[model samples]
Target: MDRATGTTDPGGGTRMTDRLLGVRRCLAAAPADLLLERLGTELARTYGTTETELLQVDYRLAALVPLSGAEPVIGAGTPAWRCFDHQSEVVQGGALHVPVTMRGDRLGVLRLAPVPDDPERRGELAEVATTLAHELVAVRPGTDRYAVGARTRRLTLAAEMQWELLPGRSRIRPSFSLAGQLEPAYAVRGDSFDWADDGQRVWLSTVNGMGEGVTASMLTCLGTNALRNARRAGLELADQASLADQAIYSYHQGIQHLSALLLELDLQTGVVTAVDAGSPRLLVLRGSEVIEQPLDDQFPLGMFDGTLYQSQRFELSVGDRLFVVSDGVPEAASQTARYGETALHRSVRRTRSMAPLEAVRSLLGDLRAFVGSDLVDDAVVVCLDWTGRV
Candidate 1:
């Protein structure tokens, strides 16, 4: 085997390939956290060593996350940037050095001990490292490598920025309360929710921009700003949606597509007027039963000019609830099943009698259980409760 050209013994190639494929299958079948653990086990098995170390590069902390095994020097304590500076493998008796790289980008270095350093062995290790790196990028939190369709540093930066724009926790109000939680919250890009009180009414809106990463984040920012301006101008729910649609259309030259829901809650009357554009189904829960709100079913905003959207009005009573969610909620799939509308409805019914925040937490907990782990796409859950007139 040659380390330079990735040449390997016939038997070694077959074994490595099998191991890589098996690892992928295992990861694909497991939850995010379990997948990491499975990866560590696979690495140990593939390397034919029990003492294996997996490190995740964290630039912010300037440290490496030890995915598995033990390395007193590099595990949990060593700074990640320091490893990049000291490129050469660090060995201090009973230790080994193996650099993990993907498409020329150095992710981190793996350290193991008591294994001989041979070209054939190193080459095989490199192949495994490459495969693992690709898997990490694919399944990593907050990233949709396939959806983005390209690998660039900008995508990571955009994801980070989008995360910063979200609400920190579920929100509470006197007449009405609203709260939202996003799955993979740290890596979300296009999904955003906003709420504002205009003394008489509370305006709530959630938007999911088309695509992912930088483009989606940019569109979301534009839509958010448009909604804010429209609300500030005392525009109605439908008018705010129209304004947002126009802003998106003009910004993208009529090329952007976005799903949005705008709701206006009149504190004095307990009336909720809403405009929905290509968003997911909204649910209104009363006691043990859940009712689905009818949507306009119009095309997503920004796809056409002069697209008129109508607002559906519903009267809210004390203890009645509203659930607004992104497609991610119903679309979340596990290895065996998807958490569809039925599951969502059941979850909502079970929590219909709970407080607004508790209901939101219950729905989120149910979603995580149904999906069996963190979701692949961004899941946004906005729960609103009407507590009688102000």
Candidate 2:
């Protein structure tokens, strides 16, 4: 181990690229339970350091729990948390913390103590973290180690279903950035979000189911998957809503229905076509002003069979930000007032200078502070930023 450089090649003269490739190979071969242990060992061998650990963000976003160690859990304001929050590297007390993210999804952070303050070595460490993140995503389905480490508390059955149904907490692309969060994460029911991009257009949806518990989860599942099926079949925005409406109607027979807000963003022109089917609200922040986009209020999904849906088209400026929220957000009430009337607007305005992912997290945190108790219904917020010129 070289104390000054905090780097080494166990093979004596191995190139950094080759070392990274070897790390990838090891990750591919390791089982889920041993995955992080293998990564730590490889990091120590490739870059001399006293400690190497992976800290995964908890489901509630409150803490970073270590994957394999007796180390204390990390919380906000720490270097590891900052690395995860900013999607960048942080160094403090001669230790390095790098984000472990795949695509736009953030899984956690990689921490290396006593790492030298060198940009080249830091970048290489980032590459190693990225490779580990990709491997974790690929192997997560076969085991529960990562999932178990991500949870600070047990999830309700409905919450588990909703979490599984999510595409991801955030996604980054050339044309746009999108992120979302659900309130009362441990026991959330009914509220869910989905999005897909097929190069030309990005489709986004938010569903607020009618009931609670597993019933609400199933209701949302039906509507969201129906929309996905339609979108995958190459249906446009309105028809996608129509198909989901028909599916929900068939399942509930007018007795149960879910409110949804659907959007399709044209990657080339920055035009957004939307179907506002229920109580969900869409707000746009252009420059410093935040304005609620008023769309024609159509019938909620499953309200009746063959509910003809219409598309409303609007253009987003290159720097515009969009917020799509389920009814749970506006309807969130304290003893004195509803969050929608004033607090929601204020919170949205406060997030104007934030990135899409951080904005979503901040807004949800504000909601939690205002409510100050377990949410009776699920609350969801999705934030999107249009960069144009894809």
Candidate 3:
């Protein structure tokens, strides 16, 4: 039987059509775990392969965790790492790997073995893997079992609270694309990101509150929601920042404060207005160089009861990329060295040619490799690419 086309799919129709129909039917009937297991088994039998596996990304361990609870999970140095790290299909040895991605976030990799050695054939197999991934993501939003399986250990109260409050892990729109990841994944605190586009303009923000544990996470959540509320009310950048600042100072008093950066991007003109409340800075990449964009200094939310926040505007040229990093990247320390701002600039230079989401994944992979251990602080990187296409 030809690998590309057998007599017929198991569903008694042409190979591609039957495979997709079968997947949709499974989606309508099976739960998350069962769906994954069934898909793996079906792929194995369909392709006459000896082994296949579905692994979800466990960012805490920086490892690929099996959804079926299998042993001997892999990550970092293998093809699974390359597939997700580069956000591209990878064919190496007898293994074929493809990233399970939706929006800008990389969910994990789909792995198969005993596949045809031809590069073109392997690419086709990777497409099948991606289709299966899309099917899984379609059903994943309404369930918690997928999230539960992705974790390697129990989550702390603060981590749980923060995770529940997230608008999403990543987002993609026509005018721009943004991606953010928080770590240690199962025990993060005082770090989060949010963004949305309202046809004409896009709103972006990142927050890192002072202190640790549940209280810190709660404060960040309040601060983030306050900004969202103000934005929804059609407040300008300065007013939105002020509302968040006033809410935190009045409600949490002098003890709690959060450093944040709020951005309003004009979709049509490629102009960006920012409200800087903390140490977070905006860096733009152009032609293999990372240039630091100056942002106005403002008081961190809750620092002063009546602080006035100012908005600083910058114009973006076509294809300019913006990076907003939590203090974690620059402050990170590896076994042999500390990851600093200069090194980060060099990294952006190295990865400048890749798409926004791919550059983000690559940079984060490097950070995890440098840190050696799970990050000690909640490191958040939000990347935005403005093509000025709108």
Candidate that would win on TM-score = 2
> Per-residue lDDT of 71-98 in model 3, one digit per residue for the tens?
5365567877777777777768877777
lDDT of 2 by residue, 81-169 (tens): 78888889999977899998998888888888878665776788899889888888888888988898788789999999999999988
Q: Put the candidates in TM-score order, highest first.
A: 2, 3, 1
TM-score of 2: 0.94
**Candidates 1 and 3, the one with greater lDDT:** 3
Q: What are the clashing pairs of model 3?
A: none
- Candidate 1: minimum summed lDDT over ten consecutive residues — where? 145-154
Clashes of each: 2, 0, 0
In order of lDDT, best first, we have 2, 3, 1
Residue-by-residue lDDT tens digits, candidate 1, 263-353: 8888888888888888866888977788988866776789898777788988877778888888888888889988887898999999765
Q: Which stretches of model 3 miss by more than 4 angstroms?
A: 1-15, 40-52, 71-77, 91-96, 112-142, 333-339, 361-372
**Candidate 2 vs candidate 3, lDDT winner:** 2
Show where candidate 2 strays beyond 4 Å.
1-12, 69-75
Superposition error at 184 for model 1 (Å): 1.7
Report how far residue 319 has shifted in candidate 3, in Å. 2.1
Question: Candidates' lDDT values, in order?
Answer: 0.67, 0.85, 0.77
